[model samples]
Target: MDQTEKNVQTLFSMGFLDIEDIKNALRISHNDLSEAVAILTNDQVRYGPYSSAGPAEDVEMKDVTSTALVPTAAPPPYNSLPDAKPCSPKPDYGNTAFPQTNLYELEQRVFVDQWSIPYKKDESLAKCLIAATSLAKEGNHP
Candidate 1:
């Protein structure tokens, strides 16, 4: 391969094929620099949303506020639940599968809730599952 291509391959291997890096690598060949970058990108060997320069080393960020958050009242003591006996087992939501129907198919479904909420009139079980799974993944469960 050519010298410019070899330099590009080396830069890519080091994850340093950003536009500025490439420009520096081909400093002796100003005419070939643009064309080299285009070739690298088209081959998917190099990519760019390239920063003009990397993060500054001198500027260190810090949070001035202490982690001991000031509160209006002292919080309750930890594990404050009374030493009560374990409550009775939750009754089984016996063998009930949520409706597998689409949102528009209201006429085709009938919902019945015995132990847990089955289905709302306008909301499909699938929709609820989708919403619930997303919320749970995000740790925003109610």
Candidate 2:
């Protein structure tokens, strides 16, 4: 709408008064800012107090300090529990899906877009692979 209509919303957003009351005030005061403000200010109790600028109803505060939060799941029984064992089938951290066979591809994947690499040691791994491959290709042992 127009600037006045926009300003009406802005006034309503100031955590005081309702749109209808603001509109009525603007209408009654012939669009005078000070007079409209005075109108809303004078008759606060008559409006039954608009809910803190938002469209939501007034929320009552409840005492939560004494109450312990309910747990999501019941604790497992101690008597029925199995003896704790070391984690079986440990993850193969060496195995990866990244370029490993080709040195050029590995170098490009490592150096070009290094940030996009998933693992922190991707560059180190790629560098090792490239070095091994270069040594192998050149018939040099190191």
Candidate 3:
């Protein structure tokens, strides 16, 4: 039902006195389970008359049922590859002009492959080179 009823039921199930005793404790302790427990324990009324007999038999039955469902076999071992090696850490290339140089080299290679442009024609390649350089500087690529 309500919170106080739940607290009374919990206290009753925890082997902590009878339903009447738990209710009285809950009432005296403002429905706080911890305070009610403390009150019951202080009065030397921790366990109910039927608590010892009922719970012990129930616990034994639960243990029997749980053990029956458990598997007795040992688990298999894990296999790992012999040739697997951890990768080396990458080198930090701090703010340098290496990327711009690499971009120029890649653009030259692409121009040579796609347009069949001879290496001697500087004037004709200048326009395409300028556009490629601008795009590479702006962190954009075709």
Candidate 4:
């Protein structure tokens, strides 16, 4: 219904924590959805220790490493490798021959046969015969 409600629902659907935990995260993160998600995900909640209901069960929590949060090392520069040529070799376009014929003339010749409509019998005579037969059957004509 509202933006805050939608954000809360989104955080709930992420399957990380409960609604109360999500609300606490949203308050701590100043209603910023991204920050709220990051806080919940990074396990930086300051309200209180999160305790699951019932007896202690073996619930596996995924290890979040700092490297996973932020990339530690930048990728090696592209040009640092040996055998890397400076500027891609100029594309070879030497004396490439192309057809010089007019495209419109070629298209007209290619489609001349397809452009003509083919008829196996006289179209007007067929229509007239069909109309006459229908009229006779309906007793509207002798």
Candidate 5:
């Protein structure tokens, strides 16, 4: 296996699937958090933000029967069943960036004038602001 795969295996074997461990093992920045998480999916170790990655890599897949092979033919259509309606496309809400009303300009100005002046470690605030912007873009509130 390649270096990345081996590293993932070693980390998984050592139970280093938590966000901090994954970040350190993968050398992933906060900005690339989603991408880092995607790697876990390849190893069948899906994990939510608040949930730990499930199971371990060394486990084997269970032997299963072929349900498809034993399947019977489809039954005749019943007259009592209602006709399936065509699904209509959802309405497109035009591109609307949020807090929607340029309120972030004030925050931007404050950031520029205060914290950003001396280049302080404002990553937390920056992430929050960026998240707010993303939420607005998705038509969701902060």
Candidate 6:
């Protein structure tokens, strides 16, 4: 279906009253579906779908889902990490900028060695880590 028809259907699902009110909300919101819903549901808003008398007094005050009222943060402009797919010949192997990409493998090896390594490190660091791991196991950890 077209834009107007789709909007009307969405409003109807949310318990909004009348085609005129939906149309007015759609216009006010510039045809954004979330904005339209928010406009229709808002108690103080002019183009809302509530009856002239308004909502029932005895009805439970439940949390309403309205996207327009919530402030949304914009996504980051660029990704820092390279994309890698599973079972590929060389998944992100060319990315020398970020070498420690296979963190899972490193962690697995560390655990297998009784959590000795902790991270990918030089021989000196590895020796220190092994000593630290022993200390930790003996309750004199640092």
Q: Which ten residues in a row have the lowest lDDT in candidate 6?
A: 76-85
Candidate 4 residue spans exceeding 4 A from truth: 43-142
Query: Clash pairs of candidate 3?
Result: none
Encode model 3's per-residue lDDT on 5-107: one tens digit a residue: 8997899889986787788777666788887787677533543443322342321111345455555453221112232223224322333233444344435
Indicate the TM-score of model 6. 0.30
Model 5 lDDT per residue over 4-80, tens place: 66555665665556644564436532224344545444434443333343443222234556545555554323222
What does each candidate score in C-alpha RMSD?
17.8, 19.5, 24.8, 27.1, 19.8, 19.7
- Better candidate number, 1 or 2, judged by TM-score: 2
lDDT digits (tens) for residues 83-128 of candidate 1: 2223224322231333334322323233322112224323444454
Q: What TM-score number comes out for model 4? A: 0.30
- Model 2 is weakest, by summed lDDT over 10 consecutive residues, at 113-122
Q: Which pairs of residues collide in candidate 1?
A: none
What pairs collide in candidate 5?
none
**lDDT (C-alpha) at residue 84 in model 2:** 21
> How many clashes (backbone N, Cα, C below 3 Å) per candidate?
0, 0, 0, 0, 0, 0
Per-model TM-score on C-alpha atoms: 0.18, 0.28, 0.30, 0.30, 0.17, 0.30
Q: Which order, best to worst by lDDT?
A: 6, 3, 2, 4, 1, 5
Error of 6 at 75 (Å): 43
Quickly count the clashes in candidate 1. Answer: 0
- Model 4 lDDT on a 0 to 1 scale: 0.49
